[model samples]
Target: MNLFRLSKGFITEVHRLFALFWWESSDVEKRLHWGSWDKLCESKNDGGLGFCDLSLFNQAMLAKHCWRFIKWPNSLVVRVIKGRYFPTSDFLHATKCSSDSFVWKSFMWGRELIEAGSRWQIGNRSSTLIYEDRWIPRRHSFKVQSPRVLGRDAKVRLLLNTSAKEVEAILSIPTGSNLDDYLLWHFEKDGNYSLKSGYKLG
Candidate 1:
């Protein structure tokens, strides 16, 4: 499940089996379900059994690999995957190919989770795309809220250094550092990914 994305049918069947097991139902007989499957899958605090949503769990599992790719970009495994899958681009911007392997596809699927929770921690080199990347450290979305204030290809450094009209929000962000900018897991205080956080985000 961590290495490959399971088909919906398979996950559905697993959910069915889980439901039957919890309800003490037999394979040959159907039983009355007291609550909807969704209700049963809710977190314990929400008053359900906190049963794992298999699809989301699977996605979370797969996302661990994606997290690894980002956290260890220079590792041998990441190097091999990048060389074959996204030689010119980073994992977040990699495009899909029809001929890509199932493992790569699963990794790509997992990348969505990372994309959702990731933000850039601006350093001296503010090369992040102003409209394309999330770096503003704001609630809701870190990307610029205004529509097309700057050129599509503009970088974040432009806002910090120049007198751009729509830069009040950008000006609030602190900049100028000695190190390179890096990705951060916005949900975690330590700026790292965890399976639990991934599952919630999933």
Candidate 2:
């Protein structure tokens, strides 16, 4: 299967191959399908053949690519994409360009899946934004972004004072000079990705 699905058009070669294999009779003539292709793409428990939907599978795979990009931002592939589409904004906050490459557009399509399943795993608060990133377990930082509540330069480090005390903060994780903030999959512990989770999301 192509890594990028329908990046330019409606269907991919994999789908075309599937149609040929499933609907064509011996050598030449096409056979009448016993059931609708959509129905056949459902789960066996749902009274269908349990065939995998190529489109959904493709989306799931693309989403994993986005996840990998975010998980390892310094990778060559991510560096290229980020350099072009999101020089100022991070992956989750990046806006779609009017004239994006087909692959870049495809990358945009799968980004939401990664965003929905991921959260910041705070090792230290350095990279996290006090008002922007989701360092808190239940939700992202402060619900409101009022100037009166927090100054413009506010950061995750602001939660702790010089005394190393919690200054109106709920988090109490220990900080170190070498610690760095990282991402984790909210659905599971030990931070692993699963195709079942991705397909279920689709």
Q: Top lDDT: which candidate number? A: 1
lDDT of each structure? 0.82, 0.66
Model 2 TM-score is 0.60
- For candidate 1, the lDDT comes to 0.82
For all predictions, the C-alpha RMSD in Å is 3.0, 7.0
User: For model 1, how does the per-residue alpha-carbon lDDT over 82-193 read when each residue is reduced to its tens digit?
Assistant: 9999999888888999999999999888989888878888887557787888886654576766666678888767753433443665666566686778888878889898
Model 2 lDDT per residue over 1-202, tens place: 3256564245555555676688875446777778877788778888988777777777778888888877788999889888999989778788997798877777777776666666676776777776666555543332223333455457667754322222333444445646688877655656665666766656
TM-score of each: 0.88, 0.60
